[model samples]
Target: MLTLTEAASRKVAEIMSKQTDPVAGLRVFVQKGGCSGYSYGMSLAPEIGSGDWVGEFGGVKVLVDPESAPVLQGVRIDFVESLQGSGFAIENPNAVRSCGCGNSFETEGTAAEGSLPGEMSV
Candidate 1:
């Protein structure tokens, strides 16, 4: 349901390559409490969970928890670098509005509909 651009996938792989511990893949999820009501979070997952939606982009495995699935659907992730900075940028089609930081967003209806109760792992 989610797609990552080549730049994003490459960045993920580059980060995973330097990890000291085992990183099964990247875990992406939505959690409540951002300035715009929800925010995206990511981490190097240690293992895939029973109900996670898994996908591989540019050879980097991406794991999304069931709760975050709907909100993240149709989202496109890209990595960008410029004089300002370099980081993963998320463009979520479902979002009605987003905070200036971009990491936080608000969608139609209640964010609680697809947001995790708290920050959680895949």
Candidate 2:
């Protein structure tokens, strides 16, 4: 299962509050790309797709697709504010290696086939 820290939940709530569209929830997914091997992606989904795993935390709905569930299991998300800046941070136990920027990661036993180069989504 995936978890979100209080700070992360609050930030998601705040962002959703400003959206004019009726967002179903925050959609988290893993796509093939990044410096390490795989990258995480997130978006405000209008509706949950079929077979999606849904969880509620801090009064917000979080959605994860089946393909990404294994990779995201036991992951903790938090919002961090520092001198450099502020943004969401993902703590993934499954990641064996991650880029210095912390946007891309590689998982043990998963091949990095089909990965493309691009900006990470969050």
Candidate 3:
């Protein structure tokens, strides 16, 4: 399951209030690219794909495509602020190595359907 910290939930609610789009939810996806082997992408869209998993926390909605859900499972989302930054962060249990930017990851997770988990520990 995906988890959201209190700060993250508030941040998500704030963002939802700002968006005019009638989205199904916040879409989270992973693809094969980035400094690491994989990169995560998120957006608010009008529809959810057939393979997407939809979840909610504190009345805010989040979506993850099936392809990305396994890799993202058991992850925590947090909001943080500092002199240099204010943004969302992902705490994923399945990543073996993440890039310096923290936006990309490489792991042997079960990111594929019907496949054995990779060299990652979830």
Candidate 4:
């Protein structure tokens, strides 16, 4: 239930190829505790979890645990290289607000007051 840009898929595949362990796919999840309310985390999955939601985009497999499925719906991931730096950037429709760093976000029903300098309310 998410989309990954070609750049993101290629980047993930490149990184996975360097890992010593056999990489089955990418694991995407959300966890509590960030400047906002939740933060995004990703890792290379060596094996798929029993309850994970799996999808393939641009030939790259992505795994989303059950707990993160709903929150990650309609999300788009992209890899960007810029003078500022390069990394995976997430555009989440479920995020009502996001921290300046772009790694943290707050969903609807958990909206908080006061915005960080670079935070955006979507």
Give the local distance difference test score of model 4: 0.85
Q: Show model 4 residue runs off by greater than 4 Å.
A: 109-122
Write down the lDDT that model 2 would get.
0.86
Candidate 3 shows a clash count of: 2
lDDT of 1 by residue, 31-58 (tens): 7767888888999999999999999999
lDDT of 3 by residue, 18-117 (tens): 8877767777767767776777777776887886788888877788876677788888888999999899888888888888988888766433422323
Q: Per-residue lDDT for 19-108 in model 4, tens only?
A: 998988999988777898888899998999998999998889999988778778899999999999999989999888888877789887
Ranking by lDDT: 1, 2, 4, 3
TM-score of 1: 0.88
RMSD of each: 3.8, 5.1, 4.8, 6.6
Across 15-91, the per-residue lDDT of candidate 2 in tens digits comes to 99999999999998898777887899989999999999999989989999887888898999899999999999999
Return the clash pairs for model 3, or none: 108-118, 108-119
The TM-scores of all predictions, comma-separated, are 0.88, 0.89, 0.82, 0.86
TM-score, candidate 4, is 0.86
Query: Where does model 1 exceed 4 Å of error?
Result: 111-122
Off by over 4 Å in 3: 110-122
Total backbone collisions for each predicted model: 0, 0, 2, 0
Per-model lDDT: 0.86, 0.86, 0.75, 0.85
